[model samples]
Target: MSDDVVAPVATAAPATHEPPARDITDGGPDMVQFLDADGQPVALNEVNSPYAEYVDAIDDEQLRSLYRDLVLVRRVDAEGHALQRQGELGLWPSLLGQEAAQVGAGRAMRPQDYAFPGYREHGVAWCKGVDPINLLGMFRGVNHGGWDSNENNFHLYTIVIGNQMLHASGYAMGVQKDGMVGTGDPERDTAVMAFTGDGGTAQGDYNESLVFASVAHSPVVFFVQNNHWAISEPNDRQFTIPPYQRARGFGIPGVRVDGNDVLASLAVTQGALDRARSGGGPTLIEAFTYRMGAHTTSDDPTKYRIAAEVDIWKKKDPIDRLRKHLESKGLADQEWLEALDAEADELALRIRTACQQMPNPPHSEMFEKVYAEPHPLVEREREEFLAYQASFEEED
Candidate 1:
C-alpha cells in the first residue's frame, strides 16, 4: 500500500480575510465560543457569527450521530487506558476530553480531504472510518500503525509530536503542484488537515511547516488542539500568545474556537476547509480545550496539576454539552441516550477483544518491509533472523 498525507464569528458578515475578535495580549484565554459551560447557547460575535449558519446546517439526526460518535470515541479512549493499565498494551495516549474538537473537525471534512494526525487523534481516525482495532496494533507492539493510510486518506499517527506538520505541508504542496487546488469542482479538489498538540507548537518543525505553507499558499488547515497542558508544562511556558495567533505572524489567518463546543468546532473547521479548497491558502485553528487525563499511560497529572483543575474542565465536557443540547432541543430522550450507552459498551468490548487478539509480527518482518526494493544488507539480516529462529527450533 502507498503512504499518503493530509473559524470564527464577527458582526455584519465580515469578509473571509477578517480576523476574529480575540485578545491574546494579556495572556488570557479568549476564544470564539458558541456554547458555554452549562451547555447553553451563547451569541456569536461578528467574526464568529458567520459560522452559526454552518452549525445550523446540522440536522437533528446528525446531532444525534455526533453525540453517539462522541460517546463511542470516549469509550474507545477509556478502554485503551484500561488495557494499558492491565498490561495489554505497552502504552496509550488517551484522547480523553478532546472529543468535540476532534469529532467536530473530522465530521466537517469531505471524503476527498486528507488528514494528518498526531498520536492522540483517535476520534479523528474513528471519523475517517479507521477501525478502532487498527489503532491498537501500535500500542500493542504489533506494528507502527495497523491501517493502510492510502485507503482512507488518513495518515498513520505521528508520535513525534511536530513531525507530521512537515509531512502535511509537503503533501499540500504536492496537491497544489498537481493542479488539485482551486478547482471549481468540489469533488475533484482536495485540502489537507494537519493536527498537532499545543506542545507541538513549540517545535521547530511546526514553525517551519507554517513558514512553508504560508509562502507556498498551500491548501492546508493547521489544526492545533490546545488542550491546556503540554505534559504538565502549561501553555504559558510555550508561548506568549495562543497557538492560533502565531498563524497571523506567518500571514496565515487564524482563529481560536471553544474546543469543547462541538458545533463551533465543526463550523469553524468547515469554513477553513472551504477556504482552502477554494485557493484561500492555509488557516490555523486553535481548539482551546483541556486534557482530562495524563499525556499518556506513563504520565501522572496529580504530580503537577490539581484534581480541582480537572474537575473544572469536566463541567465543560464536549459529549455532555452536545447531549444536553440534544435533550433540551428534544432531539434525544432518555431511552435513546440509554441505547447509545449500550452501544458504547459493545464497542468497548470489541476494542478490548480485538486489542488482545492482535498478533505479534514475525521477527523477519523487521527487514522485509524496510524498503520497496530489496537490498543485500536487508536480505542478509532477514536470513540471519530466520537462521536464528531455526537454531532455537533445532534445540527444542
Candidate 2:
C-alpha cells in the first residue's frame, strides 16, 4: 500500500545552474601593481601600470591621509572578525587584505559623491562615516540593515551579488537628470561609485550597469575588487579575460590598480572620480587585490583555494606595504604605532559591547519598512506574528 501511494522517485536532483565561464584575459594577468611587494613606488610605465595625467595633482598630505584611513579601516575589519569568533556576531566578511583598495577609493570621493556597496564593503562604509556596529548586526543576526542608505551618502549593504551596481546606475541616472555632471563648481559636482567583486562581473547586473552608465554618460565608477576568489569559485571560474576589458567593451575607459599599493590606488581612484565629476563618462577600476581571509567567517577557503595562492597574496599585503611606506617617511614611530594599536583595542571593545547589546528586533519590526504607505498584507502578517508569539507558554 505504501509503495502504491508513494510519489514516483525523482531521477535526478534539479540540475544546478553553472556559474558563468571564466575570462583568461578579462583583466591583465597578475595585477597592475605600482608599488612592488616592498611598498616603494615603482617607476611608472616600466610595469603595466598606466598613468593618468591627473595623478600629478596629488600631494604627500593626501597620501598620508590614505595611509591613516587604511590603518583604521583594517583595525575595524579585524575587530569585526574578532567579534564573530567571540560569538558576539554570527558572521563577518573580512576586508582583511583590501584596506588600501578601500581607503584609496574612499578618500578619492568628494563629500557630495555617493557610494553603493556590496555586503563586504565595510571598509568603504567606514569611509562614509558609518559606525562599524552597523556591519556587526547583519552578521550578528540582530538586524537586516544597520544604517539608512541615505544617511551617509552610502546606500544600504546589498546582499545580492552585483545588485547594487544597478542601483548605483539608477542613482547616477538621477544625478545626470539633476545636472550634477559638468557643473564645474566643485561644491556642486557629484559622482557615483559602485563597488563589487570579480565574481559579480559575471552577473548581468554588472553588464547592465555598464550599458546604462555608458549610454547615459552617467557620472559613475564601477569599482571591482577582484579579490581572486568568489567564495569557493576561483578567479579563473569567473572570467576567461580580465574584468577590466569588459569596461572597454562597454565603451568606457578602464583602469587597473595595485589594490595593495595605497599610493597607486589613491592615484587611480582620484583620477577616475575626478574625471567623472568633471563630466567624464564612467570608468571601471579593477582593484587588483586578494581576499586574505575566508569569504565570510562561515567560509573555509582551504576547500577550494590552495595554500600557495594565499601565500602568494601575502607578499602583496596592502596594510604591510602602506606601513612600509609610512615607515619610510618616518611617520610610524613606536609611539605612533603603539597609539594606533591601543586605539584599535579600544575600538574592538566598543564593537564587542555594541554587538552584545544588539537586541532582537520585535516581531512587528519585520513590517517596518516594506512600503512607503501602509500595506494590508504586511499588516495582516504582523498581526498573525503577534498572535503566534502570544501563544507561547509562560517563561521560567
Candidate 3:
C-alpha cells in the first residue's frame, strides 16, 4: 500500500556517507563457497568474506538436519515429477539439485518473514507449511494456486518471468511504511525473500526490484537460485559475468554460495536475513547450484544440454553430498538415514494417493478467484456455468 517509488543507489554496501565501490569481486562461479563438492571440510580461516562466522558454526545435528531436509525436499520434488509423468498434472518443474538452496533459505526465514517465490519454489512452500497435495493442484491444472498465500505468509506462485520481484518490492515497501523495518523486534521486523532463477536476471523487473529495494533500504533478500540452465538457455547466454555480481551494479551487498551444499546455503541465507532484519537493506544471494533434471516434465534436457554435464552434476548430487558430509561427521547413522529413506518412500505413496483423488472442478475455475468483488460479466458467466453443470446428472 505505500505507493512510493524509489531511485537507484550505486553503492556496494550500506554506509554513513556513501558505499565504497559499485563492483564486487567475481570468483568465476567459485566465490563464496564454504563447502566443497566432495563434501569435505575444505574452507577455513577466511577473512575476505563476512560469512565465515556462520560457516564455522555448523554442528553435527545441524548437518543431519540438512541431510533430512534434502531427503524430504527431494521426495516432494519427485512426487511432483511423478504427477506430471502420470498425466495427473499438466507441467512439473523439477528442483533436483537445488534442494539445499531452497530448504536452507526457506528455513532461514522467521515465521514473521514474508516470501515471494517463483513458480518452481515448491520447496520453499513446503517450508512455509503448504501441503504437498496443494502444490500439485496448480500443475494439475485444477487451480491457479494451491493455498491462500496470506495464510502462510507466501505469495502466489509467480509464472511470469521476474514479475514477483516487483510484487516483492512493493510488499517490502509496505512493511517499511507500516514501520515494520528496523523495529528492533525480530518478529516486528519483516523481511522478504524473493526467489528467482538465473534466467530471470535478464528481466527488467528483477533489476528494478533491486533498484527500489536498495534505495528504500527495504528488508528484502533477492534469492537467485542459479541452476545454471534457464530452461534451454544457459547462464552464459544471460550475462557475461555471474549473476551475484549483477547485484553490485544495483549498489547492494551480494554473495554467491555453493548452492547444492546445505551448510553453505543455510549460512549465507541466515546471514543475509539477519542483515536485512537489522536494517542493512537488501542483499542478493546467488545460490550457485545445478538443475539436475529437465526444466519441467514437458521439455527433455537431452535435446539441448549434453549428457556429460548431467553426469558431472550427478556426481555432485545435493542429497548424496550432504549425506556424505553428515556421515563423515559421525552424525549419520545407518538406521537413521535408512529410516529417513523409508519415510521418503511413504511420503511418495501418500502423495501418489492424493494425486488419484484430485477432484475435477467445474468450469467456474475460469474465474472463481480472479476478483474479490463480483463483476457483472463474471457473475453472468459463473451463473451460466452453474446452469450447465445442473444440466448433468447429480446425486441430489
TM-score of each candidate structure, all chains considered together: 0.92, 0.88, 0.89
lDDT of 2 by residue, 84-159 (tens): 8987787788988888888878877888899999988887888888888888887776676777778789888888
Which segments of candidate 3 are over 4 A away from where they belong? 1-30, 45-49, 388-396
Candidate 1 residues 121-223, lDDT tens each? Answer: 9999999999988888888978857789989999998989899999999999999999988889999789999999989999999999999999999999999
In order, what is each prediction's RMSD in angstroms?
Answer: 7.6, 10.2, 8.1
- Candidate 2: which stretches are off by over 4 Å? 1-33, 46-61, 393-396
Top candidate when judged by TM-score against the true structure: 1
Clash list (residue pairs), candidate 3:
none
Model 1 / residue 259 / CA error / Å:
0.2
Pull out the clashing pairs in model 1. 8-47, 8-48, 9-46, 9-47, 9-48, 9-49, 10-46, 10-47, 10-48, 11-46
Best candidate per lDDT, number?
Answer: 1
Separately for all candidates shown, the number of backbone clashes (residues 3 or more apart, or on different chains) is: 10, 16, 0
Better of 2 and 3 by lDDT: 3
What C-alpha lDDT values do all the predictions have?
A: 0.84, 0.77, 0.79
TM-score of 2: 0.88
